[model samples]
Target: MADPLPTSLPQDTAPPPPGIGQLFLGFLSVAVVAFGGVLPIARRALVERHRWLTPDEFTELVGLAQFLPGPNIVNLSVIVGARFRGIPGALAAFLGLTAVPAVGVVLAGMVFSRYGDVTAVADMLAGLAAAAAGLVLAMAARMAEPLWRRPQAHAILIALLAFVGIVATPVSLPVLMLTLGPVSILLAWWAQRGRP
Candidate 1:
């Protein structure tokens, strides 16, 4: 007999979401092409190429990293690493993603600092900033698609609350996770607990 509910099992798990090699290679590729726009590409690479993190997992990782110290990319690598292979994976991702980029930045900053005040550099920075903003907007739309489809009012309300909470103050994401995330889940759990 066929299972009543359909499930989407992952296709590959041999090397894990991010294999050891992908740790370096994936970040390196994103870094080179990312330029002023990386969020979408990074999402695709992780969710599609390496399968390091699912779309939902990727968003949580991005949000978690945004609140932590260091660069967003560095934080992202750590989260991806942790998810992919536990502590060792996190370590591998951190070293792989940040090492080369850090070295390159040091070298480039040395050269670029001398010409940092150049008009060309300013224009490039401006362009890149615009690109980053667009990338972020796209990510928002992509993330909200499924949420809009879900037929749960409480879930939607929780999301709206999260959105408002995030914008209303300098609230730490950890706090929001602690307060709202679980409460929302618990509310649903409680609501259904008495259902036959």
Candidate 2:
């Protein structure tokens, strides 16, 4: 297993409030630090370093995000942004997180066809491929750990089923939500009613 994370996150850090600058910088920092794996750092920066949300609250938001249809990062940006500022906050976060990376990728892709065949470039990319795999695994575990504890069995089950359903066909995102969201909500309601 990987070594334990830092015992105490840096003490000098400060909480973030609603400001376009802080919101933008917070996500930009996460995006930059997120090289091999961004989710872990992103979570720490937003929930821990910034103390924008309690760890549990962050986990709940992240959980809702994963089941949503877009890229996980975009989903996260929406939730975190909305929490901190509002819909505009969400947009700022999304732009901050996505814009630079998108442009960088476009530039890289443009160059890749020309440079891709070079042995050194190919070797570098090969390593990145492996690292990217690891990053995704880390992201999966980060997402899964919380749900296991809270034991949202039905949501988990529905997510699993929705995953399978998506895999089984080429359904669009809206349709997939149409298929899964209500069912999950109904199940959640039933589960809540059964409790207490």
Candidate 3:
């Protein structure tokens, strides 16, 4: 019998790409909802709600974003926008993603500077930090879900090695990437080479 899993990540038939307005609003909504971290919310918005990208696509874009300079989410926003609607779309998504958050940060900074010494204010900030940590953990699990579903064991093995290398061993990120990154690309290419 043929292998059940596709040689590459499965691509669903996606809806037409979003217009500039939609891109703006989609990212705006993500910005408004996700306070400290946006990955979980962005994933939900793009994959689950909008169906703009499949889970695997989201993971791929995020991985690329991580390798680029600047904030991962910022890079993701720009990449998605550019992929869909070119330069204008990139501007729209970038503006939508940052505008409100930038204003909020400035206002928050001012407020915190004033009330930072208060016990209640400090406690609230502490609570937000804890919540952010939880969100990060949740997002990490969601990101790994695609890898778990893929049939090829090599993907999982590579992910495990990278995790162990980073967390348990003393290998630096650049060193680890230099070692495993090429292997990953080659494996992915080889896996799909038979596809028409």
Candidate 4:
């Protein structure tokens, strides 16, 4: 007799593709609330809340976005939108992601121009910056969870080296990418060579 099929198959099924309106509203919500960075919010809404992408899928999308030139989250939105509904969806998601934030930034600039010297405004801005930093740190920790769970020494080594190169030393991003990108790829290939 053949072996029994896995009972957890349903959990692996992909979610339904979202409509254009859903894409727009989802991105719009993420943009409005993500003060310092949109990535974490985007991940939460798309992966956790909307069930649009799995965590591993989201990580892959983020990787692709990082490899591209533009803002990572914006690039991700374009990729996701296009994947779901084509060019129109891409436009809708991009616009929804940027429009209100653009207007809010302009209005904030106007307010700052008027109240640039106000002590209260300065204090509020400082607090916002601190909160933004905390958000970024939290996002970093969350992103690292998968890696930590898998625990590949080479991957962790590369990550640490990249962090130290970028943050502690004067090595620029382009330089590090050029140096480490091929190395990582080669290591991955080598590791998988003996596998089935």
Candidate ordering by TM-score (highest first): 4, 3, 2, 1
Best by lDDT: 3
Candidate 1 residue 69 C-alpha distance from true site, Å? 5.0
Residue pair clashes in candidate 1: none
The TM-score obtained by model 2 is 0.74
Flag the better candidate by lDDT, 2 or 4.
4
How do all models score by TM-score? 0.70, 0.74, 0.85, 0.88
Model 3 has an lDDT value of 0.90
Superposed Cα RMSD, model 4: 4.7
lDDT of 1 by residue, 1-196 (tens): 9768747555754344557666767877776666556677788788777666767777667766766766777889877777767888788777876666678789889977898799998898789799889998897787666567655667678778888888997888679767886778787797688579
Q: Kindly indicate the candidate among 2 and 3 with the higher TM-score.
A: 3
The whole-model lDDT of each prediction reads 0.74, 0.79, 0.90, 0.87
Relative to the unseen true structure, what is the C-alpha lDDT of residue 115 in candidate 3, on a scale of 0 to 100? Answer: 90
lDDT of 2 by residue, 91-121 (tens): 8888888877888789899899788889999
Q: What is candidate 4's lDDT per residue for 78-148, written digit by digit as tens?
A: 99899899998999899889999999999999999999899999999999999889888888888888788
The true-versus-predicted C-alpha distance at residue 85 of model 1, in Å, is: 2.4
lDDT of 3 by residue, 61-156 (tens): 998887776899999999999989999999899999999999999999999999999999999989999999999999999999987786576688
Q: How accurate is candidate 2 locally (lDDT)?
A: 0.79
**Better lDDT candidate (2, 3):** 3
lDDT, candidate 3, at 25: 94
